[model samples]
Target: DIDRKHIHIVSVRVDETGKKISDSFEKKRSDAIRKELEKKYSLLPAEKQRQPENLPLKRVDYKAGDVKKQVSNVAKVVMKSYRFQSLNEYRAVLSIYGVTVEEVKGEVRGKAYNGLVYSALDRKGEKVGNPFKASLIGKTAGYDALQKRIAFSKQSMKEKAVYNRSRNIISTLLANKPDRKVFEKELAKNGISVLFRENDDKRIYGVTFIDHQEKTVFNGSRLGKEFSANVFHELFNRNGRQDSSGIDYEKQFHINNQDYQPEQESTAEAIAGIFSMEQHGDDYEELAFTNRMKRRKKKRKGFGL
Candidate 1:
């Protein structure tokens, strides 16, 4: 999270003459100045180190059979809730994130296996969603490696999509200077910022536009598999409970024989089901309320109107 008010903006301008300065005698002068500044900064005292706060961590141990059973249970619950016409739709969404499903088998002929009937593997051949198989991946070096690979793959895909869209917009804008200015102005009006521009060589490079006051609303780190499951559970299982005062609160749906409270149940299940799931506990609602109050206070404090 960033403090939007503390953001600083720096602007750099480059023109034909400025470019010539870099190519000529100014290069040596700039390099010497940079070295001098670096030497001066190196003599400064080190900053005080802050003590690291310890976080609670837990390890889950389950076998392949246990994972199979959990997946089957979760699948059954999802199917019952969702109005999917076919199993294909369910499988398709899972496959989008490179999840592979396989059926478990019995060693004895004609006898059914009590263990996991299906297992899921990620793109890196490591178990992703299946808790039973996750232990294997974690024990090996595959878990961390696969996670990084998947994250990078997804980010690359998103960047490519954004780049393609930007290219089309840029091409359209280049048709006319007045239209280009209009496009930039429209983007500014909407607070849709950019961060790069072209140089005299026609090569697009360097930061162009940045929204100093805009705090990033969502972080990819918070949208991992566990978070997805929590969101899914909240959206699907939980019903909005209306209080006497007419305020609605999200309540988790519970089945028979569960000891966890609504929010705890959903969060625990989500954590147990997904890989790298962090325990956010029941603080989401409280945090939201606190943030709302803070925003209200800031609004009152900063804006007299």
Candidate 2:
């Protein structure tokens, strides 16, 4: 297993305009600099020098973390900026970054299952970063998470249609600028639930919206840039401001009038499933408690007519 906590520094070059040059461009520049250094180092007295050979000419083995950082930098810039719904889609994107995702055998729940690992090739077509787990590199790129993220696309033919319809419903509802609470409630009526992801700082970073009726899940960014966490936070903040001014934000928001029978109370379970998908192993109880409370409602007795 690789230790993910180690941080590594990467060398980069900036042009005269202060823009970071491409990796290939920077490598060419570094090669030129290396030749100059070698010339100067060769002229030094043998007794006064650390080594007779120039330091730049010495073979350098990059640390494991350094390799991880290199692969991740490419993955982040090329793979993450767009919506990818499946491992195939993810693999395709990785290829563009000069990397490939591979399936390997791994133990899950004490039984062996197919898992994902990654590899990249050098200019000479020599493979590097041998069989590193996707999770070891990043959470969102993990095998389990990718399965959940693209679960909708993997649905059966009939259910996949339902999933697409739910997507349309969610897309329309989000366009109305409903706050987080309102969005969840509204989507839940159609058997969809939104799962918001936060970091240690409690700032929203990502979201997955799951449709229980269709048995499918989708990343919010997969829907559109407007549906990302930042836009969701914006809607939430606007709702708070609107509520303080005594404005009925819900009333102003457009929702179809047709009586859509609300689905059964599956929101809590669905959200919990999302937590499981995210691999929050130690925080399961915490996530379950929070989601349970959010879905719980107080009972009110009604007068007999």
TM-score, per-candidate, Cα-based: 0.21, 0.33
Tens digits of per-residue lDDT, candidate 1, 187-224, equal 33332233222223322212122221221111211223
Pairing residues by index, what is the TM-score of model 2?
A: 0.33
Q: Candidate 1 regions off by >4 Å?
A: 1-66, 69-133, 137-143, 160-293
Q: Compared with the true structure, what per-residue lDDT tens digits does model 2 show for residues 1-305?
A: 12235355575478889997777776678657766777778754423533322111101123434666556554443333333455544544343234557666768899988667766644222455565677777865666766664553444333335447666887888778665555665665565545565545444555666544443445666656877766765677655631212322233222232221121232222222222122212444346545654555322222321
Best by lDDT: 2
Candidate 2 minimal-lDDT segment of 10 residues: 52-61
List candidate 2 stretches off by more than 4 Å: 1-163, 238-305
Q: After superposition, how far is residue 25 of candidate 1 from its true place, in Å?
A: 64
Cand. 1 Cα-lDDT:
0.31
